[model samples]
Target: MTGVVRLATRGSELALWQTKWVVSLLPVPTEIVTVETEGDRDQERSLTEIGGQGVFVKEIQRHVLDRRATIAVHSAKDLPSTSVDGLVVGAWLPRANPFDAIVGCTLSELAPRARVGTSSLRRSAQLRALRPDVDIVSLRGNIRTRLTKGKGLDAIFVAAAALERLEIQPPVVEILDARVMMPQVGQGVVAVECRADDREMIQLLSALSDRETELSVLAERSFLRTFGTGCSLPIGAFAEMQDGTIMLSAMVAAPDGTRVLRGSLRGEDPEQLGGLLASDLVERGALALLSASEGKG
Candidate 1:
């Protein structure tokens, strides 16, 4: 806790902002070690074709495991549901806005057959559910590039938390309600991963962890783990605390947006609540929808 903590992160403006925010919260000196993962280099290919979001995370995690860095900071939602071997999410900062943001126009404001851009399957599926008449195009890049790309399209889907953290102002900023577009698991949370054997780093990072955020994400991740997937699957899970109780909500949708299953459960035990809700979805034929999407990919 007294010495400098070496933090590894992706080399993006949003990533740097998140890491710097973490650094500001720490007591000791912190140095950032920028690491570019596969996702950064292969900007044109689809995430599913290139091994999912894990492509953006693996290299960063390696730095911590190899001792090049003492810790790795990441957007919680980008992380895989299952914990990596020898690494643990030592801390989760307080949550941010979990709803997705639309730039250039609101969902309802868009004209029928209007072109919308997004790189995420979840976002596309939800948007299609709302506007089957619109055209969805593949859009991939950083915030600046996406904004630039949006100039060609009628609208774009982005994380509200990312825009809020960067204090960006778009021509049209509309925050989508989570009820209409379920958020990905661990959205709006920042998590730091440390080697399991490094008790010192664990203790140091643990001090910054917020219990409420940790529990909320725990339940969300539990749902994801039960479903056995990462971002590759068109599924979304979100959890929040309400009056000392946990409410877990999740959705499973076809990539084409033909079918969508939504469910929620309230309880004290985070893991149980997550599993129970997941089961509700499975019993309601979510498995079939997930299977069809997997086959298409």
Candidate 2:
């Protein structure tokens, strides 16, 4: 809080919202350094085609690495599962609604073979499982654009956190439950990253950290890292606190939703619990499901 903290972030509305949220909680003056990422530049292509979860984060982290900024703010879900050398996620803000929302129409309202838009493999696969008759098409862009975009589609799927953060409640939004379509790992969370050597800044940022949120993140992303995958794979995990222990549920599915392997595990150790859940999944042929898919999942 003694020095000016420059925050590097993607130049998107949702990204900015997450950045400012981090800034507001800190005691230091913040300078927003907006970076136009490869992901931002190419909205029409699927995320897997570009670079999966790392597409939006690498450039922003470059600013921090090169001393252009002090920290990087990102949607937690956009981050890669692997750790980056010389950098660490110092803190996480309190999580928000961690689920997907169907915008512009209800799930059952769309006609058979009705065109639906989404870019997430997890969402697309789950949607296909829910309604095999509907056509799932690739659609990309910001929250505003996706909500208004046309691909002869009946509706678009988006994160519930984005809409709620942007104060957008489209007339036909249907909040999909985690039971139906499990959420992406780290969804609805905001992460703040800093250089490994920046002790002062890391300590300051730690003050804003919520321990429960941090534990949930540890469990969720532990599964991702142990599984060794990122976005683009049809995988989903959601971790939450039940009473005092951490309860984790995860799913791995075929790209076409023909087969889904899922399991849950609960314990005190977040990391161990996630790892155990993943082991259970692998025993249930999750490795086959993961191997069948290409790119990061």
**Would you give me the overall lDDT of model 2?**
0.87
lDDT to native, each model: 0.89, 0.87
Give per-residue lDDT, candidate 1, residue 74. 95
Tens digit per residue, CA lDDT, model 1, 184-207: 888899999999999988898889
On lDDT, the candidate that comes out on top is 1
Q: Against the true structure, what is every candidate's RMSD? A: 1.2, 1.5
Give the TM-score (vs. native) of candidate 2: 0.96
* Model 2 CA deviation exceeding 4 Å by range: 150-152, 295-297
**Full-model lDDT, candidate 1:** 0.89
lDDT digits (tens) for residues 73-94 of candidate 2: 9898989988788899999899
> What TM-score would each prediction reach against the true structure?
0.97, 0.96
State how far residue 147 of model 2 sits from its true place (Å).
0.6
